[model samples]
Target: MPSRILFVHVCIVVFLFSVPLAFGAQSTADVPVTKELREKALKDILGKTKELPKIEKEYVIGHGDYLRVQVYGEGDMAAADISIGGEPRSADAPRQGRGVKVQLDGRISLKHIGDVEAVGLTLTQLADYLKILFATVFDDPVVTVVLEQSNSQRYTVMGKVANPGIFFIDYPITLVQVIARCGGFTEWANSEVTVVRKGAEENKLFKKNIMKFDYDDFLEGKKVERNIFIKSGDYIIVH
Candidate 1:
């Protein structure tokens, strides 16, 4: 009877220890897997911004742009008193020229030249071309073209942002500035962001025309250079 009792007690002790050991092993295996997966996901999300190149191309003219055309001595040909499409301007209109809106046909109407093709030309290129065209009416014509308001270049911001819509950008703007202009992130938004660029070349640096950024890491001042300039026709998606 004593031997049987001892054997029973030993078996109970062994079973108790083994049960805890099994649970501990299972917990250890699960914890590391969860941690590793989380880390990998974070790395994948933020790593895509590492190789983005800076965009520094000149602004090209397009439809829906506003232009300020100035002639050295000619006021009638300027954008001051002349509305777009040759419409009459009000007397109280500002003298600084509210600019001529580019028509849907990618052309702007001038006093002497009539409709001039303004799309696909840089500001300087347009200015030089105007000089050539105005040479018929004036001796050694001096002309300057300023991009007053650019309604042509637009970008879309969607997903988890306060204001998700298409926004116009006149100048080169960074990612942070774009987010701020869009009213920042929503309450359920994560720091992960993806940018879908339309004209991005497929190379080792870019994949599937997509780029990612971690707003939290950027806010912490890490990878500041990855806050790339937002291009026209780009879609910014906040996760």
Candidate 2:
């Protein structure tokens, strides 16, 4: 009887220890990723993340932009007689670029050109416009316009971030990078991040495309989902 009782105790101990081992194997097997699941995941990934657009587009000039302006041949007074494009007809390239500021009224006041409309033009286009304006004073003016500072492509970041404010973005930046630029999230910040984009819809008079981005998944370094590019008129809210 004593030997039988000892054997029963040993059996009970073995059974108790084996229970967790058995459940561990079953738990792993419960979520078995079949071929169907893998294909679905692949399809979801392919469908969700479209290729991001190129970052640098031709920037439109707006108010508060510092512009570099240069009138090449005008400095010589007799520019038409001296050079073709601010250089000797036989020379290789042009001269250095100069600058001006777009006032609040969306016009740049140059010495000779005076106030010329610059708000809606690109740097190249502004150069062309300035050339025409300078023609009144100089003979065949060659103008070069370069944007020294831009305030147009800026976005606002608010709510639950360490530092929240408007950020000016020059190059192509992702939403993930935007959060980092705003000093990441606060302790109370959740994964529900919102991006409010303002533009027109195909058939509607006005439209705002609001999207939810998961900063938690973004923090995980997921390559595909974290690549949503920042558009021109985006207001990113972190919560």
Candidate 3:
């Protein structure tokens, strides 16, 4: 009877341990990934996280920008130059001529050429065009264009970040990099970040001029492609 009671106790112990193991396995299996969860997971990734192709990094002219146009060896005609205002020391000195700000109308007035369109053209393209325009005034004019101040290549970050403010960018940067630039997220910051893009054309990657970036998902390697590049005039908000 003693041996039989000992055997029964061992059986009860084995049964108790085995039941929870089986129950746990069954419980975990019961919660299969639901269709809604599957769809949301796919939506979070599709058309969102893919890295964009290498975009041309050339800076284009924009409104409210300051430009310095120099015509070498033409100091007498330097009054026609567009630069920050200063009288040239000599006829041969680099023309520190008057600077012209890009007007709201996207045109700059030259002394002789009048208002010529300066927006939407690169510095090299503008210089070449200016050469043709200045040819009528100077004999073989050497034209050079310099961007004095850039006011358009800027973005803003707001809400739930360590540092949130307008930031200037000279090169293409990713959302992750921009977040890092602004000192990362606050303690209570949400991972769901919204990028409000203004004056941007609708594209396959971004629709309705809005992009939803899941920073946490990206960190988890589930949505690795969500680190999209930041563009000018973009507003990043972390809730």
Candidate 4:
């Protein structure tokens, strides 16, 4: 009788352990679809999410930069020129020609205006400063500055893209636009995308599920919110 009782106890232990193993296997099988659902939810909120990198607002002037200086009503200094750093040109040199290069100290020398710091200032802000400086000599000197050529304005794209590299942009760009420029995604690309923005404390991730959209509805411009605006220095990962 005691032997029969011991055998029963052992059987109970074995059955209990097998029950947990069976449940664990079933739970594991459910995980993939759950992950996909979570990804779908994330996409709906973040749009085409990419990891945004740290963006600093420091200006480092470089060669081939075109600057247009206008002095309000004064009008005498209204001209566009490039930066080509060197000694003063000879009197015989062409007056309206040649690129203007930033000096080693990030300064540009203009006729009658002397040396001015061109780095770290946006064109509009720089114009205002020039206006104030010129005001010291000319009465109510209105100033305007324009950048015809610039090497400093650039952003980069990478990961799960056909072509990943640095891109130069002259105007505002969106996340979908950047992806299109990079040649779209690959076969293994995930509907979810992440963007790393500049100055963000952490990376922002976004996911998009292609399965939920109706082919005809999307084509008719029904779902335009899927494409989100992309900022500078955004890293897009389609995985």
Candidate 5:
């Protein structure tokens, strides 16, 4: 009787200790996606600014950027003030300022000035360049350049996701949410994802920001740091 009682007590003790072990072993990564979690992430990413490394204050114009240029004095040469939706105007109609988009080749094509190299130039730099370019055509052309839209802040997502392509980093987004935005993963997708961020210096050789993400902790809604803040030119690979 004593031997049987001791065995029962030992079994109960083992079961009690094993419960914690099992729970501890279960990572939050396997938790299912919840509305609350997504809402929290959405709130966190939106309305946040991701500063570029090194030059945190400056916003350099790059490929796929849209800019608005205004030229004063001697009238609007390129219709700088033309509204989008208005009746078709005659050749003699008043011209207004216009917005220009930076092509994939990092060049901007103005009405008469042709292509202007815009990549790597700030708004001020581009304004000065435009002034010089327009000076030849107009008498003392005072130019102003403003960034209308920034496509240079786009990030690339590839591998395992449904729609893998370049996605604009309109706001600060996390790795996991970005994957969802790309249409989630495929059947053969792996839980691990890799992130590659470009260095700030164009010429200088520097270490790339390479990080890994484990999707398991995310599944259980547990506090995990797998979700990282992404920036422009950052690439995410979900394998």
Candidate 6:
């Protein structure tokens, strides 16, 4: 009887150990990845490989925008000028041309032309318009314009970056280039990035993951959607 009891106890122990292995093998086999399953996994890993956001060519003029205007044949009118007090004046103002303000309405008071709209129009466009306006008084007037101080053109970079300050972007800039300007990411930065832009009614948000692919690949047109062109006043947050 003692021998039989010992044999039964040994059998129970063996059976208990074998039960886990059997179930583990069966469970793994039952969960075999099919062709469809493999494809789905690849898709999830690769993410959406479609085109990224294109760099846009748009700008808005803001306050304290220094402008240099030159009228061919009119030496007095053709000079380096600054927008002071929402008024376009010669660079050599009474007080060294300081304390100038560009109005939100985008209007600049010119000597001959009163209240010229300078915000919406580019420097070149403003020159053409000025030529047309000056043509009424002077014949065959040639006009040239250049931007000196771009106080209103700026973008903000925050969160996880070495330098989280407002950057002045005069022209269109890419996400990778902008990050480089900000001194790269911090140690605890999350791979995901976001941009908040002011819309017509509310703000819009755009999110991207930086860890999945190389930043160079995204900037060099591989994933265009990830290389969005940053606009003035847009905020980039790298969590």
Candidates in order, TM-scores: namely: 0.65, 0.61, 0.59, 0.49, 0.53, 0.54
TM-score of 2: 0.61
* Best of the two (4, 5) by TM-score: 5
lDDT, candidate 5, 1-239, per-residue tens:
99999999999999999999898776553575675886567667763564323424567898766678778645433333334445325322322223666777888877668788889998988888888988888876778788766667777888998888877665668887898888899999988888877673442222355766779767887536657677777888889
Tens-digit lDDT string for candidate 3 (1-239): 99999999999999999999999986864475665886667667765666534537567988767777778766422234454547545322333224666778998777677888989999988988998999998877778888776655788899998888877665679999988988899999889888888755555556687878888788788666668778888888898
| Full-model lDDT for every candidate | 0.78, 0.68, 0.76, 0.60, 0.72, 0.64
In TM-score terms, which candidate is top? 1
Off by over 4 Å in 1: 1-56, 76-97, 202-205
Mark the 10 consecutive residues where model 1 has the least summed lDDT. 88-97
Find the candidate with the highest lDDT and give its number. Answer: 1
Candidate 4 versus the native: TM-score? 0.49
Q: How are the candidates ranked when ordered by TM-score, highest leading?
A: 1, 2, 3, 6, 5, 4
Model 2 agreement with the true structure over 175-236: per-residue lDDT tens digits: 88888887888999887788777652441312356666776565687535544778767788
* lDDT (Cα, tens digit) per residue for candidate 4, span 177-202: 77778788777676556565556544
Could you tell me the lDDT of residue 166 within candidate 4?
73
Q: What TM-score should be assigned to candidate 1? A: 0.65
Higher-lDDT candidate of 2 and 6: 2
Q: Candidates 3 and 4: which is better by TM-score? A: 3
The local distance difference test score of model 5 is: 0.72
Candidate 4 vs candidate 6, TM-score winner: 6
lDDT of each residue in 1-239, candidate 1, tens digit only: 99999999999999999999999986763353454686667668769666533435668998877788878877536433534344325322222225776778999888788889999999988988998999998987778888876677888888998877787775679988988887899999999988889768753334788888899999899877768888888888999
